[model samples]
Target: MKHLAALNKYFWKYRFRLLAGLVFVVLSNYFSVLAPLITKYVVNKLMLLLSPGTTHAFHESVQDPLARVLINRIDRWNFSNVVALCGVTLLVLALLRGLFMFFMRQTIIVMSRHIEFDQKNEVYQHYQRLDTTFYRSHSTGDLMNRITEDVSRVRMFTGPAIMYLVNLLALIGLSVYYMLKDNVALTLYTLAPLPLLAVTIYFVNQLIHKKSERIQALLSDLTTNAQQSYSGIRVIKSFVQEKAMLAFFRNSSEEYKTNALGLAKVEAIYFPAMSFVVGISTLLTILIGGFMYIRDPQSMTFGTLTEFVLFINMLMFPVSAIGSVASMTQRAAASQKRLNEFLRLQPEIRDKPKATPKVIAGDLHFDHVSFTYSHTGIKALTDFDLHIRKGQKVAIIGRTGSGKTTVAQLLLRMFDPDQGAVKVDGTDIRDITLKSLREQISYVPQDVFLFSDTVRGNILFGNPVATMDQVRQAAKQAVVDGEIAGFAEGYDTMIGERGVTLSGGQKQRVSIARALIKDPRVIVMDDCLSAVDARTEREIIGQLYEYLQDKTAIIITHRIFSLFQFDQVVVLDDGHIIERGTHDSLLEAGGYYADLYARQRERDERPSEEEVTQEK
Candidate 1:
């Protein structure tokens, strides 16, 4: 019921259709009750037809002599007429039942589809707004399960659960009404076990709900395992750990199986116990009616007894349906909990009241900024101060964990800083809308990632409306134009999932081209040239300087050779700035940069000089 309560808004929107379906159900139930009366007439008529002189015996079973006379006068002794009446009743009941079932299904399906559509979209949109902090803590497969499998469970609850429960209630009400009309004493006797049946359902659902939640959680774990294995298939093969991966998957699957079996066991016990109650009610009805018939034949008519049995028979399906719907409702309740947990989360980054969309000129300044992750409590950046005037090329160098990428992320507004401010064109980035800030900056990460799409599409991703000439020009600037032309279809060649079809260097170049096409005011290249050879890095940098003469650029790298071309260099250590100067000035100071440069120059000369002297 709680799960159903969450879905009430969607249910209300189409309540009219539900009402129409219910009206059909009421009509269908009434016709079904009439069906047993027609059946009773057919049975009694058949008995009378075979034994023509037994009309007096049939009448003697009635309580009142006037009622017996009335029945006797109405009992036409014709086989065809009785058969025709039974056939017409069966046809009418079948038609009404079929029509009601169709409408019920239609309404339920429409409701579930609309609900699922809205729910999925809402979840996806929420996921989009959530910061990297959430993603780093959760797996892709877990999110996928929340969006797909969990939502499907909600659909099952709304669709089949609604259909069955509504029809079951109608069936029970009609059956009870007809049973009482036939014989009040027998009807009361038949209902003796109903309260126990209800109690069984309630507890069984409690157990089912607990186990179902566990099973769904285990299923998410299994999905996570499978997704990780597939995404890291190359790593698995390289490490020769296929057996280990298989063992992990097998364990996850076994856990899921055990939980599912536990759920199945609950169902197995609930239904049999529920059915026993139904059987007991049926047996009691028969015993009571038979005794009443034998001791006081005038108390009941054969037709009335037959109709009572038929009505009880109709009650069986709805009663059994209650057990089944109970199981579905429990599963839906568990799924609802998962969906609500995800939906209730607010994004770590929120827009300000004065946030407005404004185009960026990419003049960035970091003013005594500091940040720490919420969980780790370790500062990624501490009182970091730097500035990049418009159209300046600034290279950042640092050891691992020196907060190199944090600068780029802050510029993109991935997460707001805990202290100080990051501004672009004299406007605090936090005050600008996230979309507008991102539109003016392009980031190419060290570990390049590309979508499963054509090369042209990947290149134009940053500027989807860019012309083909613009895409080609950006590709050429990244020095990948010749390589793209070598492909069978050139820029039309499709990169496989996550760009697996391309080599490491090729992927980096493609991503670079993607950023280049954006023609962004600020371009952030985070160690993007690491994979390429030194000579190629120089060539790319040459082309980059020429192409980006009027744009601000942030280059993060470790190569001392690559450090010489920047308009200014900023060196970081332990999340603190250690050096900020031109290349020659830092070298003359004979500090950290001087030591790194002299070591690199010695390594390059020693190998080359020996090779040359041997050749001479």
Candidate 2:
């Protein structure tokens, strides 16, 4: 019932189809009730005519127009005409019942399929609107199952389970009403075990519900493990850890097997118990009705006894079907709970209300900005303030986790500062739409991720509408155009997942070209040149520097040569700026930068001499 109200919005749109299906179920149940009554009429009416002394009396008693015409056709007719009329009525009702049933099945199928499509699309669109930080804390497999398997469960429950329950209730209501009308005393005796059967089914359903939850959880875990193993298969193969990976998978499979067997054990017991209840109901019907008929054969007619027996048989399927639907509904409810939990979580970051997109002029500022990922007050950056004007290149140097990447993330609005302001073009970034702010700058991350696509497709990712000539120009600036052209298909060659067909350096170059294609006012390169050789790195940077001289650029790198080309450099140690000046001025100040430059120069002069090294 938690998400029931929310789900009903979708239900209302398809209410017409659902109403039509329900009408068919009612009509079908009505026809089924008619079968018992028709049988009773034939038995009682035929007995009177065939009693050996009432042939003329039976023919005179038929005063109805349809009956008189049939009776007039025969001389000394007994019960054959009456039997033939009942058969024709039954055949007509059967045909009409089949027509309604066909409509019911088709409408339910169409309604459920459309609902599934809408739910899946809604989930995907909602996921895109969520903040990137949400993805950082969740796995790919978990989200995949929510969209694939969880939506599937909702679809199945809505279609077959809902229809079956409606039909079962209709059948039970009509059957009981007719049974009581035939003979109240006989109905009481036959239904005496109904309460006991209901109680037993209730307990069995509760057991299955708990076991089914466990099985769903186990299935999710197994899916996560399999997805992770497949994504990291290259690492396993390279390290020759195939046997170890297999052992882990075998253990996960065993856990899945255990939970599945637990569910099976409950179902195995429940089905047979249902059958046993139906058997007992049958036994009671025959015993009580048979005794009453023998004691006073004239008091109880043959037609009434036949109707009672037919109604008892109808109860078998409804009771069993109700239990099956209950089990499926519980599983669907569990899946719905998980999916709603994800959809309700508010993203940690959002644009301000009434915020507008602002055009930036390439001037950036951080004023007394302090930040911590933890609301518990562990600071990642403290009182951080810096200014970079247009047409200036600034390089930041720091050890890993010394808050270097945090600077880039904060600038991109990945998270907001705990206290203080980050302004671009003299306007606070928090006051502008994120789309407008991010559009002015391009970021090349430390780790390059390429899709399974063509070389040209990857390069022009930032600008999909770019022409082929522009794509080639961007690739040429990245210094990998020649290498790509040598391939069998040149720019048309397909790259495997994450560019498995390319080397680390090649992938990094492709990432750089993607950023370059955007042609933004500012560029932030976070160790973007780490994988390439020195000569190629220099050539790429030389071409990039000429084109980027008039744009604001921030370069973070471990290479002293990469930093020397920048106009100004800032040295950060322990989340505090230790030195900030031009490349020559920093060396003249004889601070951290001076010492780092001296050590690097010595390394170039002599490889055998060992000295202090910074780990990043």
**Candidate No. with top TM-score:** 1
User: How many Å off is the CA of 526 in candidate 1?
Assistant: 1.1
Highest lDDT among the candidates is held by which one?
1
lDDT of each: 0.83, 0.79
Task: State the lDDT of candidate 1 residue by residue for 1-616, as single tens digits.
Answer: 7655778877787788767767766766766766776666666666666767764455333343433444465566467764775586579778987786777677666777888898889889999988889998998889999999999998888878887888788888877865675578878988989999988888888899899899989989999999999999999999999999999999999999988998998899887887788888878878888788778645665666777777777787788888888888889889988988888898878788899998888789999899887867878999999988998988888888889998888888888899999999999988899888888899998889899999999998989999999999998999889899999999999989999999888899989999999988899999987788666777788889887889999988776754336788888887899998988888898888888888878875665665789999
Candidate 1 at residue 459, lDDT?
93
Q: What TM-score do all the candidates reach, one by one?
A: 0.92, 0.88
Alpha carbon lDDT at 14, candidate 1: 72
Off by over 4 Å in 1: 47-77, 561-564, 602-616
* CA lDDT, candidate 1, residue 216: 88
**Which window of 10 residues has the lowest lDDT sum in candidate 2?**
54-63
